[model samples]
Target: MNPASPLDNVRIVLSHTSHPGNIGATARAMKTMGLSRLYLVNPKSFPDSEADARASNARDILESACVCTSLEEAMGDTFLAAALTARSRDLSHPTRNARQAAGELIRYAHHHPVALLFGRESAGLTSAEISHCQLTVQIPANSAYSSLNLAAAVQIMAYELRMVLEEGVVADEPDPQLPEPASLQEIEGLHHHLEQVMVQSGFLDPTQPKRLMRRMRRLFARTRLEKEEVNILRGLLTAVNPHKPT
Candidate 1:
């Protein structure tokens, strides 16, 4: 029997997708790559005939897709989120080529939830949306006309992930003594706790907040903090502000 695929823990998140056909085609693309988890965030049209028709034999993926009201909801438990975009932004997160990002995600998904986040068809993810992602992945395309169909982009990413699994390019199993990496929710909680302490301690001013917190978020995003590490950090934050609980 074949070994289980790490793709099982990697979810495809379509954010505010405008076209139902693309949504269906994305599901088909993911299914072809042996990826079944699909999360839709505020899709314009779903459960529509066009999507069902496009999905074809992969209709099961569409039927089981998790629909959420927001990206945060879709990424609730995901430990890593890689945003797909071609545009450059003023404030960007750590970036990697599609292949590199896919390999990293495959390794992480071996034992935890990770996500590939794609934006709408007309325009890619907003800077605010991109900020939430820990990494950005850009596909190399013709510079003159770099635009790709939403489904095509999904296919490319899914293909890379499938290749990683088929080629057995994954991180070795952990030693089991170390705590598991913290989940996205846990990390977000840590951020919240830290921010509260920072504000209370006068380290960060809420009124004219510079990119301080954003930079901190980026710094922590790349840390891949373990559960124990997060606990230790939270403990430090509590120590800093003993009068007020974080």
Candidate 2:
């Protein structure tokens, strides 16, 4: 049997959303990021034509969305819940940047369900609603004018969640078919060979080497030269000065 996707364990909750179109757009955003679980807490409008029109290809997400009467009901069975808010309150949970908070949420979602809660469009989450979350995430934006539309906020959070999950998976599952990178020994050989050619060619001064080799090493490191690339570079260096030991 196919293992369940980590995304299945994530729920995007919108509380007291005013516009049905924003819900539809949010669904589209979530669907683009491979998130399908959606919960609406006392939305002003659902099953509205504007929502259906905006959902477009992501109508499935909206069609299956769970509508609840309250935020508590929407957060049911979630092991971790993060509230997205721009406001600062005395009693609110300590806030984290979106990416940092998403990483924590991704880790929790590995073992249990997690929820990302967003508040109303006009006035974000109430203090009472914010208290229900274990963490509060604030998207870093220009503080002078940092108000984001309901759908835009949802898109940013959904994108962050998808990125964290995808990044973790990529780290854990390297492609077996891809060639291994050039080893330190091979890279060193290439560097030494290039230095010999450069010295012979008079482009580099071996007598007074000042950060030249170090800069070259940094350049190669940035390239992440593959084994084949190193071999090609060695051949090119040999061509430059065949008399020098390659």
Candidate 3:
């Protein structure tokens, strides 16, 4: 792996993971694929003996893993995040197979930080959790018995990403003249600002808020907003409602 490989900018995020052993196994899996960044969101257990034992030689990855209270915090700095899900969703982001998504993620990972999200061992990622991500990825499997272990899923995705890197296949370099992509934190802030303006302007009724914001999120998710674009939109929102803070 190159010292400054794009994999360095890609993080593997496991949310609400229940098994410490799986966490350890995931660390081992990530290390094998040259992916070192690991973020744990509301995991059931960590820094435990079981996890340490499972990690084996990859204990260093476990030691350096980041633990966060929420998925938002775990991916705040990431420019793009893709959720791994087996089930279909009503208003989901664009769906892709593991290999295709790996290629797309690697493209963005070259210019900015990106993340891959995995959910709980049993239920997988919630709709709300999936909504937080900009893209959804599914691993093709036998329809009859497609269930996969948490660590197994991570390993599959990691391997695909590694393949993309090793093959020297990546998107063209980003134009330096354009502004950087918007980080998750900035996008969330824009969402909040937009909502505030909508509420104050009586455009979004707070009493019966339904899928309006969810649709808005989906719309923006498709756009892959840049930092400057986000700022411009927020500025417009502020203009619409001067009393509201940007």
Number of the candidate with higher lDDT, 1 or 3: 3
Tell me each candidate's TM-score: 0.91, 0.67, 0.94
Kindly report which residue stretches of model 3 are placed more than 4 angstroms away from their true locations once superposed.
Answer: 171-179, 242-246
Clashing pairs in 2: none
* Model 1 lDDT tens row, 129-233: 776778899998999999999999999999998887777767558456656888878888888898888888888898865478778777887777788899999
Q: What is the model-wide C-alpha lDDT for candidate 3?
A: 0.90
Q: Estimate the lDDT of model 2.
A: 0.79
Q: Give the TM-score of candidate 3.
A: 0.94
Mind sharing the TM-score for model 2?
0.67
Off by over 4 Å in 1: 1-3, 171-179, 242-246
RMSD of 1: 2.2
Give a tens-digit lDDT track for model 3, residues 1-246.
Answer: 887888999999999999999999999999999999999998998888998998889999999999999988899999999999996689888899999999999988887889999999999998888878899999998899889999999999999999997787774576677668899999999999988888888899998765888888888999999999999999898788957555
Poorly placed runs, candidate 2 (over 4 Å): 1-3, 169-246
Arrange candidates by lDDT, highest first: which order? 3, 1, 2
TM-score of 1: 0.91
Worst 10 residues of 1 by lDDT: 169-178
